[model samples]
Target: MTLLPKNPSRLIREDDRDSAVERLREAYAEGHLTHEELDGRLGRALTARTRRELGAALASLPEERAGTTSTIATAAGRIRRRGAWRVPRSLKVASAFGRVYLDLSRAVIEYPVVDIELRLGTGRAKITVPRDAIVDVEDLRTGWKDTLYKTRRRSRPGGPKIRISGIMGFGRLKIRHARR
Candidate 1:
């Protein structure tokens, strides 16, 4: 059974192609694919058009395990993460009196689901998730200001799910999904 949908003929997205390339590189580094095979697959990956072609580039490669929880806490400073950083299974962020900016739009989130725990005493916290990500903030408790999340888009069938649970004492917490 293929992982793709029944039609499976849709054009692949740029992010999907990029992810496939990273997986191929990882497989080669792990000695799973030979140099010649890697070169051949890399060409197909870079020029892959449809989902089938993209999937083929990542076929037979073993999956990477999700890492343990990562914690980033600060008393009075800035905490930021962006670029192609690897996302772990769980993330705990605590800020007493500072700004926290977490941009997960370009982050590599391999897991199907992830949990983010936040504890903001007093400061602004901005989080940007992936476009196709599903965010849940049901368990979040806030005071002084309500959490701002204006996205209504649901995650794709195989997209990632982000669950946020935490307590905000006195500040604003804004969560926005990537528009790109």
Candidate 2:
């Protein structure tokens, strides 16, 4: 999604609604939202047709902290987290008919190993990690012609290890070292 300045008048996309729904789920998990409130907000979020509506759905939730574990899911939009964002100890990403990007070159890692759970249905995912990081994808299961590509890079001792475990139904999952 395009990272535009906070403009109230700009149109919201389906990805925005999905993001709002995720926030609502997080709020529910954090005890900030009751079951009824989460259901109502989720309904509004799924049916929201405008950015303002989506914003309203998430207005009551607290802002996400930088270092907390986050679950990012999307139905039909792109999900990309990059740059200097903090890498959660366990990050879960689920996508369908969308694209997922996890760039960990500049991420702050607090754990010696990060667990990444990826669920992709007819979507693609690209994970870029530092050359020194170790990536283990032994638990990944793919269906049909689904593909997973890992470009080799030297892995150093004591570097963060990324353990990926998930199910892939079609599409591709590519893991590459960050370009210098």
Candidate 3:
């Protein structure tokens, strides 16, 4: 008799798991989820081995329901956020062989600080922000091609700050200021 392999769960990366946890925290902070729910989902997220399991863990969260605004680009498609769109405090992007563009020049930003969690696989992400807003990409992890940020001046007072953090593989992340 031949031995067959069991149905193994689709393994998830540590960074992906961490991102899910962060989303949970944001949900809790926004008063969308209680402490008990956060704890339970966090626990489930930490132990989740498959993407489906992780997705299930966060399926019922308010942020994922209708609370936050986010964009995702996959396969060979392109995702863009421009004009007067609402900017959520927490933004998550997952791109594989796709392009993600975020133009925040005239966006309606509700939070003073925005956190962007990105996962890039052989893809690219370009972000355009207001000239006065601050941009931070220290938390980003790129491969051979390092992420780039082009700005005119340093962060000013009362300006919105964008925090970009996450993992990248064979991709590029560029941050530019919108043209006047």
- The best candidate by TM-score is 1
Q: lDDT: which is higher, 1 or 2?
A: 1
* Candidate 3 wrong stretches, greater than 4 Å: 1-66, 69-71
Clashes (N, CA, C under 3 Å) per candidate: 0, 0, 0
Give the per-residue Cα lDDT of candidate 1 at 51: 81
In candidate 1, residue 100 scores what lDDT? 91
User: Per-residue error at 95 for model 1, in Å?
Assistant: 1.0
How many backbone collisions does model 2 have? 0
Tell me the tens digit of each residue's lDDT in model 2 across 5-63.
56646667877876677667666765798999999889888977777778888885777
Selected candidate, larger lDDT, 1 vs 3: 1
Whole-model lDDT values for every prediction: 0.86, 0.80, 0.81
| Per-residue accuracy of model 1 over 1-180 as CA lDDT, tens digit each | 747555644878889888889888767766889999999999999998898778888888887666569999999999999876777889999999999999999887878998999999999899999988888999889988999997664556666888999998898889998978
Candidate 2 — which residues are off by over 4 angstroms?
1-68, 151-153
Candidate 3, overall lDDT? Answer: 0.81
- What would the TM-score be for candidate 3 when compared with the true structure? 0.59
Winner by lDDT: 1
lDDT at 130, model 3: 79
Return the candidate ranking by TM-score, descending.
Answer: 1, 2, 3
